[model samples]
Target: MNTATHPSESHEKLWDLIKDIKFGMLTHRHATGMMHSCPLTTQNKKLDEDSQLYFFISRKSELASALAADANVNVSYADPGKDSYVSVSGVAAIREDQAKKQALWSAPAKAWFAGGVDDPDLALLAISIDHAEYWDVKESKMVQLAKMAAAAFTGKQPRMGEHKELNLS
Candidate 1:
């Protein structure tokens, strides 16, 4: 079972867990009923009050076309060194808002979109997060290994650290 947190608190916690993780694996369902994923750099400096995540994608890419057909998506972030993993499910859409593009634009993004925020191929992808879950292990590696070994012998599941689910809907 997962612990529950207040909506705003959960949002903050979720952001805290993923903010430093450089890449999120975004999985989108293709029209042909296959799920495809790609690593996309998260663009938000901070999580929006509306619980949205943004990324810059190529308009000509298959991902763009797949999202147009089905907007539901999942984005997962992991920081193995910290033993933290987060999975966020949401609805995705490509935005054409110029002001937003300018706001999220960064110097590093210029490497891909040389024309900057005005690049024609640049598509702003926004994911309106509805639900998210995270696993954060605070125990030492040795302790975790011992628990795993015990569980293996006893045929019981090992207890990790906190696991929580957040609903933003």
Candidate 2:
């Protein structure tokens, strides 16, 4: 629980892990007060200076409505191959910025938003990250397993992965 406080290098480490993990699962509270989650594609290949993350979503979608009703949300990303995971808590607000949409738009998005940036339903979901936590282990699975076995044989605890918690606000 040493990482329960603010982390010094968490921001940079989080960016490195998430930059290549293009997809994240966004969770929000529904009108009925139930928690819902869905996978979303990130607008940024990396995070902004202020630690904000963006996603393109449909204005008419359930997530958009959820965001309008309650801004608090959580986004999670996982890079299993790299033994990295990130959880970001933030407040989401919808933005109708065609310029930003244009900048972030790609051929992959065309599959959903047929009219591209000009689509009426197209909107940007801006997440102003307030806090984040990450688990980043550089060791491979086999190495971890070997260490665990050695620790068991020696009657010691296995060393776990690195975990950092940050206050982004």
Best prediction by TM-score: 1
Native-vs-model 2 lDDT? 0.85
On lDDT, the candidate that comes out on top is: 1
Residue pairs with backbone overlap in model 1: none
Candidate 1, residue 138: the lDDT equals: 98
List residue ranges in candidate 1 displaced over 4 A: 3-5
lDDT of 1 by residue, 115-163 (tens): 9999999999999999999999999999999999999999999998999
Rate residue 26 of model 1 by lDDT. Answer: 98
Instruction: Assess candidate 2 and give its TM-score to the true structure.
Output: 0.88
Alpha-carbon RMSD to native, per candidate: 1.3, 2.4
Writing each residue's lDDT as its tens digit, candidate 2 over 26-103 gives 999989999999999998866667778989898999888888889999999998888889899999998777787888
What lDDT would each prediction earn against the true structure? 0.94, 0.85
